[model samples]
Target: MTEAAAQRAGRDAEAAPSLLYLVKRTEQAVRARLDEVLKPAGVTALQYTALTVLERHDGLTAAQLARDSFVTAQSMADMVRTLEARGHVVRSPNPVNRRELLIALTELGHRLLDDYRRPVRELEHRMTGGLSAPEVDQLRAALDSAWRQLN
Candidate 1:
């Protein structure tokens, strides 16, 4: 290949946005669409995700759930309060740790989650439309590696 052609190729590559920028933009688009789809259910995606985590790890503290779900403690606290008001979550004295309160999904919480679970799964797939299974796996691996490298 001629030197001029090689230089032109390098310039074209440099002119394109980095993969990280595209990934971040795509993530934002997914979040925006999810939030829109979740609006009618009267629950944000974050709230629903936290509830899912609580379902998986029943009787978890707000702190524990926050850490597991990658959310802030204050955000979890707010969600718990909202869920409690909606009759979806029950906060009780921690049996093992009296000093801190533990949160659990009430029977109502489980039912409500069940109702929304189908739509949630559908929305997730829709948001990730056009991505193949292997492509999704590659994205996951890349993100996990990036997170570990950064933190």
Candidate 2:
């Protein structure tokens, strides 16, 4: 190839965003959508994620919830307090670790999740609407693999 053609090709490649950039962009878009969808429920996307994590693992420390919910420990502490104040979650002394309190979802939290289930599902469907079932499966696998590799 001519040197000028090769230089143009290199510039074009450099102009394209990296895979990681695309992945993070997608995450941002999803979070924005979640914020809109959950706004009526009076919950932010991060809070909803924490509640879901607690739903899956009933009792976890603020630090654990923070890690799972992709927030800082301080942020999780604040969130726990907010959720508790809202009667969506409760904190009790951990039987295994008396000094630490475990956060758990309350009945109200579960109901909140149930109420938003359909909307959340619809959001997910919209995300993958362009892909075939097999392609969706592959996308999930690929994303999971990437996560596992980094994690």
> Best candidate per TM-score, number?
2
Supply the global lDDT for candidate 2: 0.96
CA lDDT, every prediction? 0.86, 0.96
Task: Give the 10-residue window scoring lowest on summed lDDT in candidate 2.
Answer: 95-104
lDDT of 1: 0.86
Which candidate comes out best when scored by lDDT? 2
Candidate 2 at residue 79, lDDT? 92
Residue 91 in model 2: lDDT? 95
State each model's C-alpha RMSD to the native. 2.4, 1.2
Q: Write one digit per residue (lDDT tens) for candidate 1, span 2-76.
A: 999999999999999998899899878877776777787788778878888988999999999899877899988
Q: Could you tally the backbone clashes for each prediction?
A: 0, 0
